[model samples]
Target: MPSSRPRCSAGSSSWSTAAATPTSSARIAVSIERSRPEAVAALALDAYGLSARERQIAALLLAGLSTQDIAARLYLSPHTVRDHVKTVFAKTGVRSRPALTAALRPI
Candidate 1:
């Protein structure tokens, strides 16, 4: 079988970087920068003083989970999940998920 990855030529890269050569430190640095927002959001969430349930729901919200999905995962009803979401929004001082994300974003 032949490798699906393309040869590492000047103008072309492998179809998947997994089969490519090792990346440079600069790429690693960029990866770190790209990942910082999630860490920042998580840190901001922790500082909000949410209750255990509210924190769980808020974390799921940050992960982009829907109320039904969070309810299914946590064995709660959708109505309950929605109530938690609303409380989380109020506590975080944001009206919607995008606003919540923006509020938690790093300065």
Candidate 2:
């Protein structure tokens, strides 16, 4: 059986370290140290300037799903997934998913 518990990476220099979990197949649940939630929010805002849905998509992308896989999981059409990816690229100023992930990384 697949483990439900998530693997966590210690956050970057700008944010405090805390445990995070992968909850539903849809999204991960991260428990940031109390002092750092605001900073995390700020970093997310700065990096992608994404709406909540876009941010969720970007997060899923970072978790490494192909467009088709993303579509299947998100219940979106593949074309819609591609469109969101395009918007994600434009908003984050990154041409590719790897770049987008790197950009989303902590400062």
Candidate 3:
């Protein structure tokens, strides 16, 4: 039998990260194009044995936040966040944020 899952076009997915907007409210609003939940991604990352901090950073990365932004938001050094990210990638078998997100797409 063929797989029941819907066939998507090449390079397409049902979800996408939110794009940056000019206003805080815009930042918080979820659009149809950006409907993927961070929690689902977090759950995916959980299978990799990530620490709480590492999971948080992974979620932010999936949300398209930069290392500098993650550092400011979490009150850590950018270097520290990068360290966590390196560990995350090592454990998760991914080398970049886009690969990480793709690897962790919801089951």
Candidate 4:
């Protein structure tokens, strides 16, 4: 019998559905469960003392996006994004992306 389970493909930053089967369904469920905590942690940006714009930029930065990419997503200029990044660094006392990510990651 043809499997009815969902087949997922790795998209840019998430899964894309192509077909369905029981095994794939289970995998998708597991993936979602695993990501739930990380998602909640990402929402806790306020704990870092970042402003609204800074929080948005920081979230995208933590997601591995470049300043240009974040600027495009937020429809702001690249310079503006860079300014926000610098502010975030100063506030968090981290001078680089990896450092910022490490500082913000849940213990």
Question: Which candidate's lDDT is highest?
Answer: 3
Candidate 1, 1-107: lDDT as tens digits:
22233222122221112232334553321111123445445556767878889888987887899888999999999999999999999888999999987676542
Worst 10 residues of 2 by lDDT: 1-10
Give the clash count for each candidate: 0, 0, 0, 8
Candidate 2's displacement at residue 103, Å, is 0.7
lDDT of 3 by residue, 1-93 (tens): 221221222334445443333454544433334444554465567778999999889888888999999999999999999999999999999
- Cα lDDT tens digits, model 2, 1-107, are 33342223354535555555666696666565433443453456455577777876787887788989989998999999899889888987889988876766543
Q: Against the true structure, candidate 2 has what lDDT?
A: 0.68
Ranking by lDDT: 3, 4, 2, 1
- Root mean square deviation (Cα) for candidate 2: 10.8
| lDDT head-to-head 3 vs 4, winner | 3
How many clashes does the backbone of model 3 have? 0
The true-structure Cα RMSD of candidate 3 reads 12.0
Evaluated against the true structure, the overall lDDT of model 4 is: 0.70
lDDT of 2 at 89: 86
Query: Which residue pairs does candidate 1 place in steric collision?
Result: none
Candidate 4 lDDT, 24-86, residue by residue in tens: 445432222123424444545666678989989888998999988999999999999999999
* Residue 31 in candidate 1, Cα distance off native in Å: 18
Residue pairs with backbone atoms closer than 3 Å in model 4 (clashes): 4-20, 4-21, 5-20, 5-21, 5-22, 6-20, 6-21, 7-19
Give the runs in model 1 whose Cα sits over 4 Å from its true position.
1-36
